[model samples]
Target: MTSLDIAFLATGAITVAAALLAVTTRHLVHSALWLVLALGGLAGCYLVLGAELVALVQVLVYVGAVVVLVIFAMMLTRAPIGPSPDHSTSRLHRLLAAVLGAGVTALLLAVLLPLGGEVVARTPVSTTGIAEDIFGTWVWPFEALSLLLLIALIGAFAVSRLTRPAGEVRR
Candidate 1:
């Protein structure tokens, strides 16, 4: 097999292993670290697929900002850093989840494999076109996302303030 095929296989394996670890790890911090590895593997896959912009954004936005925020929130809330509380689901629930996941996977494979052959023939649009479409047709959603970020920032600030010692009142 080609080097590219080998690299893809290796990355895919790492991604799956990291994902499994993230779900199965009892320690909250260890789970988050495994999640970071899984996300990094995804970025590597994006790079392999020749989507450098997507890869960079995935690393920056997901690994950098979102994960950091999650870690900070965990610290702020004084969540137990030790093993998580035992919260095993019933066997029936596990069976249902497995069946649902299998159905979704089969459906996606059926739909996507047929469409994949057509994607190679299409000419890629310029980055500017993507920007214009987002700023023009999707302006409202873009603005809403910005507003959501603002609200999150305000909420974080409010929560941190509330958690502070009562004797240290803000001016």
Candidate 2:
């Protein structure tokens, strides 16, 4: 196998593991950090697929903006840091999880095995075209993202103000 294939598989495995950990972790902040790792791995996958624009956008939009907003929101909401014992799973739950995981694996194999690992040709997409599409057609989503960032900043301000000691005067 080519080095790119090895890198892609390694990155995909990291992405999947991080994503699973992000959901299963008992600590809130740790979940967000793991989500960042997962998103970074996704960007690496995009890079390996020869889609530089997509990789850049995945890193910038997801890791830079979305993850930062999530972290800020967690901080603003005073999310728990340490693991919570209550988050522990029961044996029944573990069994159910294993079943679900195996089912998913079976489904993926059933789908992909039929294709015989065929490589589909993808049209080379230009950055200029992507930029135009994002800015022109999907302008509302861009604006919404900016709004979300603004809201996160405002929430951070409000949270800081609330946590301030009562004796401290606002500047």
Candidate 3:
């Protein structure tokens, strides 16, 4: 009906299509790449909703960090890059995922929609204040998370090194 509505619809469509492709693709690497597209589209949708900080976090955290971590994990585990020998997700897993997704959808609708189905107005949030709060009060937790990630990296390296060929020297 309007330009903003059209933009939202377009972003939502891209997100759905990319998410479907991500799940359905046979190739592992291609699935990860498609996931990036899906994540980016969701971030775009967040941007269209005026949630700039959320969009940025979605792109930076999910696409940049999580997806990269997954890709690296796949490489580290020596997962097949081409078409998987078997489906990426088993039939039972897919069925469970569908059920979980549907349940979440129902829960959200129940919570967000009013008894009369009237829309609720929301006030826009300021990104500057959020950034200030994150950098100031929440800095310690952020640093702690960084330390935890470092420990995880060290553990991964240890595991990989231990699993290397017997003749190979420890790194």
User: Which candidate's TM-score is highest?
Assistant: 2
lDDT of 3 by residue, 1-171 (tens): 989999999999999999999987888899999999999999999999887887997898779877887787777666678875554677898899989989999999898776557766967679987788877898898778668766766665665555556788632
Task: Candidate 1: give the clashing pairs.
Answer: none
Where model 3 places Cα greater than 4 Å from the true spot, the runs are 86-100, 110-116, 136-141, 164-171
lDDT per residue for candidate 1 within 1-171, as digits (tens), equals 888888888888999999989876778888889999999999988777666666786898679866776677677655578864454566798799878888999999999999877746657766577557766897898678557756775666567656567688543
Model 1 ranges with Cα > 4 A deviation: 86-88, 115-119, 122-150, 153-157, 160-171
In every candidate, how many clashes are there? 0, 0, 0
Error of 2 at 63 (Å): 0.8
| Full-model lDDT for every candidate | 0.77, 0.87, 0.83
The better-scoring model by TM-score among 2 and 3 is: 2
